[model samples]
Target chain A: MSGLLSPGTKVRVRDDWPETRGPCHIRTPHYLRGAEGVVEKHLGAFPNPEDLAFARPASRLNLYHVRFVPQAIWPDAGGEALVVELYETWLEAA
Target chain B: MSEVLETPSDRLLAAVRQLLTDKGVVSREEISERIQATDAATPAQGARMVAKAWVDPAFRARMLADGAKAAEELGIPMRGMPPLGVLEDTAEEHNLVVCTLCSCYPRAVLGYPPFWFKSAAYRARAVRDPRGLLREFGTELPQAVKLRVVDSTADYRWMVLPLRPAGTEGWSEEQLAAVVREGDMIGVTFPKVS
Candidate 1:
C-alpha cells in the first residue's frame, strides 16, 4: 500500500507465471509483455482484477498504469499509439 | 509445394503452437483440432448464438443471467474452459475487453481477436481513452451515451453481447447475425446494415 513507484519508473510484466493465473480476457496487447514503462496513474488498493477474477479473496495485488511509448514495443506502431497501462502487480522493476 | 508455404502470421502461429507443445499446455492433435475448427468463413458461431438473444427477450434475459448455460443451449461446449463471463453490452452500458496479464480469450464463442485488437495501440488506448478507441473502431457515440471501458484480466475470459441495433424490426435471425461483426460482438462496433 506504501511504495514509491512514481512516474517514469521502469516496470516489467511478470510473464513467467502460469498462463491461467490472472484475469481472462480475449486479447492482451503484446507490447506490454516483459516490457518496461512509466507509472502514469495509480487507482489505489483495489482487488487487482487480474487475480480477483479468479476469486482470490485472500491474495490482493495493487494495480497501476505503466506507460510505454508505441515505437519502443511495436516495430510498426508508426508512433501513432499512446503509452500502455499495466497494473502494479502485473509490473515490477525492469 | 504450396506456393503459400507460410506467411509471417502463420509462422507466428506455428511458433506459438510449438511453444504450447513445449509448455505441455496442448498436444499436436489438440492444436490441429483447434485449427480445423477455426477459419474466417465460420467465425464466432456460439458467440453469435448469444447475440441472437437480443431479438428474443426471453433469451436475452437468460443470456444476461446465465451466459454459460445459454451457451450450452446452443451446443457450445465450454468444459475445461477457464472462468468465463459474458458481458452483455446494453444501450446504457458499453463494455470493452482487455487482457492486461496475457491474451487469454474465449475461443469457444468468439474465435480469435483481430491482430489489431491484440495490439498495444488498442490495449492502452481503450482504457486511457474510451471515446477515441470507439472512434478508431468507426462507432462514434454521442457524448450523451456514457462509455464505460472494462479492462479484463487473466482470471476470466470475456465475450461481449452488443446491444441489438435499432431499425432491425422484423429481421430474421440470419439477417441479424450478418451485421454482428467480430468487432461488434467484442463491443467495439455497433451492429450496422451490412
Candidate 2:
C-alpha cells in the first residue's frame, strides 16, 4: 500500500460500489465519491479499516491527503478546497 | 425514593466492562489510569506549543514537520494514539479540521473535544458548507483567502497552527500562550491581542 501511490498523484475517487463490497463501513466519505482531486500528501499506511471494522485480518492500505477544489465537489460553492484523507482502495488512477 | 435509571448504552458499557474485567483483558485500575491521563491533558498544552512556535523559528519548523514528535519534545504524552499533524494557517490560506466519520482529535494536546465537534450537524455541514459553518462560529474570513478544510478521516489527528496576532511584538512565550485559545487551535476562531 505504501508504494502504490506517491504524493502529488492525480486520482479519481471511485463513484460506484459493487454489491459484493459488503456493508458500507469504510472510512471514505460518500460525498467524495466520483470527485477528482490531487494527492496532497501520503499520510502513511494503516490496516484496511473495512476489514478491521468486521474483525477480520486487515491488510494495509495507503492513505493519502487528497485535495479537491470547491468547484469539483460543489459547482456553486466558493473557491475553497477540501482535503480529505482517503485509502488506496477508494481511489483510481485518473 | 425512586431508583435512578440507566440508559441502554450505559448498561451495555457496564456489561462490557464487567466482561473485560472477568476475562482479565483489562483491570479497573488500568482503565482509571488511562482516563486520568486523558483528563490531565488540556488546551493549555496546545496553546503552549503554538506560543513556542510563534517565538522560536526552529520549533515552528519541527512542529510543522512532525506534530507528534514536536509535542513529545514539549513533554506531551501521545501514547496509543495515531500520528499528529499540525496545519499552519498563513496569510494566503486558512485551515480547518473536521472528522465526518467520528471525532478524531489530538486529545493528547487539546484535552477533551468540545461537544459541538461531535455533533452530527457539525460533521455534515463542515464538509458541505465550511464557510457558512465558520461564519456560525463568528469567523468571517476574507473572500480572497483560500479556505482549506481538512477532514480527519484517517489514522492521523490534526490541529491548526494559527498565525500570531499583530502588535504583540516583544511578548514572552507565556504571554503569547495566554492569547491562544482552544477554538483558535481548532481553526473555528482566530487569536486576538485582547
Candidate 3:
C-alpha cells in the first residue's frame, strides 16, 4: 500500500536473468528485461506468480502497466508503443 | 531419430489428474464437466458485447469502465477470474493484445487460445515485430495510427474493441456481430462487411 509507484513514473525493468533458477515461472518477458519505460497505470497488487508456481507461500506485489516505444525494445520495430504489466519487484527507478 | 510419445508436461498432467482423483479432491465427472464448460465459451460471447457497445452508448461506457462486470451483465460468469480490460480502437489508434510470457487469455469469453497464440514465434514476434505480424495476418495500418500492443503478462487480461468498419450503418446487432471474428477482437484482423 505504501510507496507504490504511480503512473508516468520513469522506470526500468531489472535485467536479472532467471536462468540460474531452473524450472521457474516468470511473468515478465525476457525481451523486456533491461528495457526502460514509463508507468502507464497501476493494476493493483496480486500474489507473486513466481512463488505460486512452486506452491510457495507468496506475498502480494503491486503491478503496473509499463509502456515503451517499440523501437526502445527492438531497434528495428515500428514507431508504435508496447505495454506490459510488470510486478513492482521487477522494476526500478530509471 | 528416436520417436517420442509424450512430453514432460503431458506426463505431469496425467500424474496430477491421477493424484487428484486418488485423493478425492476432484471427481472425474467434475473434471470432465469443467473441461466441457471451458470449451463451451467462444468468440461469439465477445462479439455480442462488441455489437451491443456499438448500438448502445451506455453499455459501451460501462464496458470501457469495467469489462468483467459488463460481461457479467450479459450472463457470462467472471467470478474468480482475472480482471478483463477492454481496449477501444479508434481512427487515430489501434489495440493489439498478446501474452508474451504465456497464453493468458480471457477464457470465460473467448474460450481457449488458438494454437498459433501459444507458439513461441507469435510470442516473440508480437513484441519485436508487431507490424510484420499484423501484415502476415492481413491487417494493414497507416503509420499515423498508433498501434498499441498490450502484453497481458500478469494478472489482467485484455481484448480489443476494433473500430467498426465503414458501411453497415443500418445493420442490426446480429449482422454486426456476424462480421466480428475472433481475429478482430485479438487485433490481428478487422471485421469486414464483405
| Model number with the top DockQ | 3
DockQ of model 1 vs. true complex: 0.07
Q: Residue A91: error of model 1 in Å? A: 16
Candidate 1 stretches with Cα past 4 Å from truth are A1-94, B1-42
Q: Write down the lDDT of every candidate, Cα atoms only.
A: 0.62, 0.88, 0.88
State which candidate has the highest TM-score: 2
Model 1 per-residue lDDT tens digits across residues B1-194 = 65767789999988998999999999999877655655422345743675578677887777766666677777666555554456666566666666544465666677776787678787666656666778877878766565555456544556678777778789888777777777766677777864
Error of 2 at A79 (Å): 4.8
Q: What are the per-residue Cα lDDT tens digits for candidate 3 across B1-194?
A: 99879999999999999999999999999788777667777999899889989998999999988999999998877766789989999999998888887798988888778899889899888878888899999888888898999988989989899888899799899999999988899998999988
Where does the lowest 10-residue lDDT sum fall in candidate 3 chain A? A1-10
lDDT of 1 by residue, A4-89 (tens): 47766667666554455754632234545666566755533444554455665645445454456545665544222233334455
- How would the docking of model 2 be graded? medium
Candidate 3 chain B, run of 10 with poorest lDDT:
B32-41
Chain A of candidate 2 gets a TM-score of 0.85
lDDT string, candidate 2, A1-94, tens digits: 2366867788999987653576746788777889899999888889988788789999888889999986777776653888988998888888
